[model samples]
Target: MRTGGGSMTTPVHNSPRTLVLSTKTWERELAAELVRLGHSPAKSRYVANKLLKRIVGRAGWQRQAFLVD
Candidate 1:
């Protein structure tokens, strides 16, 4: 995992209220990213969870991680 210090890119179309509401991050940096991506914090959170679960679930070992030996 990144140490919350790496650089990320977001579109320049989103607003601060959106960033805060969607991303739910008190961190100014993260909120900035949410704006850059043109996503409300809520949109960011929703998209992140949706895509992440698919990626994680695609790994064969991921199922094992959710199950007992």
Candidate 2:
């Protein structure tokens, strides 16, 4: 990753769960949720997409807690 003036460009990660939200409400809501979850704003899309994928992806993987209680 390269950084200039304290901001770094994030590279796209390879994820099996990749979702592209089209509805404005969905996009906005997901971005807000991701931010609330502490992800950087710049990475909101990637994080949100990955999350959507997991939600709608083929069912075969074990579930992990996103937040520890």
Model 2 residue runs over 4 Å out of place are 1-24, 59-69
What lDDT score is found at residue 1 in candidate 1? 18
- The CA lDDT of each predicted structure is 0.40, 0.50
Model 1, position 26, has a per-residue lDDT of 24
Count of clashing pairs, candidate 1: 7
* Candidate number of the best lDDT: 2
* TM-score for all models, in order of appearance: 0.36, 0.41
lDDT of 1 by residue, 43-63 (tens): 665565555456556764342
Give me the displacement of residue 56 in model 2, in angstroms.
0.5
Residues 1-45, candidate 2: write the lDDT tens digits. Answer: 112322322233544233322333344467778888888999997
